[model samples]
Target: MTLVARIRALPADLDDLAGAAAAEGFGMLGVLAREWVAGTQRFAMPEEALFAARDGAGVLLGIGGVTRDPWAPALRMRRFYVRPPARGRGIGRALVAAALDHARGAGAAMVRLRAPAAAARFWEGCGFRPIDDPTATHGLEWPGRG
Candidate 1:
């Protein structure tokens, strides 16, 4: 109820959310933690960001991030995860929307993501069209792009 998405300044602060994700068989959160700790990635680019969704009580419901694609020109959405109990409540969508807004503010024209097959419908529902690229499974182009 009334989830708010906010940019996270440090990955270490996401330990609880990351642990929950790992328990649910998602490894991206762990990767986020390790990469951040190792200085390999921190979602610190001018056009990149990490967002966490929290309820009124400050409980983390989900987390996600955007970054310049390592293999493409578009910004890439990554490390997205929502707790099982929080699924279907729009928490994930809110996180995605926040990440998109962040990208749009940075003048990005497109966003890409490599979603699992199970999440195809979810991504599509958010306006990301299925793609046949190896580095990305779905993409969303900004409206009015010529």
Candidate 2:
């Protein structure tokens, strides 16, 4: 099993993933980014990201992303997606591992995300706890890293 691959954000990757997002009922990141690109004072910061999982013949299989703000103590899980064919193969678990590693390396005090409600159970299974605070993004948080 190819277990993982790390592809940094490329413009083309953004285009390729639009279909995935739509199919899975997640936000269209390319549309968001394109709109952002068109806005004044908005710039793309190549996010600190990681992707892992198996490819047949020992290629990597997982997909995930993390954002690290150098001066801020927060880490944001930008996105995570596993190809439909790879589901149930532990690829999601592997991707989570890599994303968390990205967080830790970025000196994050905690990791946060606004996962679509459909992914609530999966993310909960990945160890993210729902927060009671309604104001927080998607009302969730990963326990603070010590």
Model 1: lDDT to the true structure: 0.86
lDDT of 1 by residue, 51-133 (tens): 88877877877888899999888899999998888999898888999999999999888899999888899999999999889
Off by over 4 Å in 1: 11-13
Model 1 vs truth, CA RMSD: 1.7
- Reference-based lDDT, each prediction: 0.86, 0.59
TM-score for all models, in order of appearance: 0.91, 0.67
- Give the Cα error of residue 74 in candidate 2, in Å: 1.3
lDDT of 2 by residue, 1-146 (tens): 65565654434445445566667776645544564467521223443665645577643333566664333355666557766766887788788777777666655667766667777788888878776544333322445554
Write down the worst ten-residue block by lDDT for model 2: 133-142
lDDT of model 2, residue 98? 78
Error of 1 at 7 (Å): 2.8
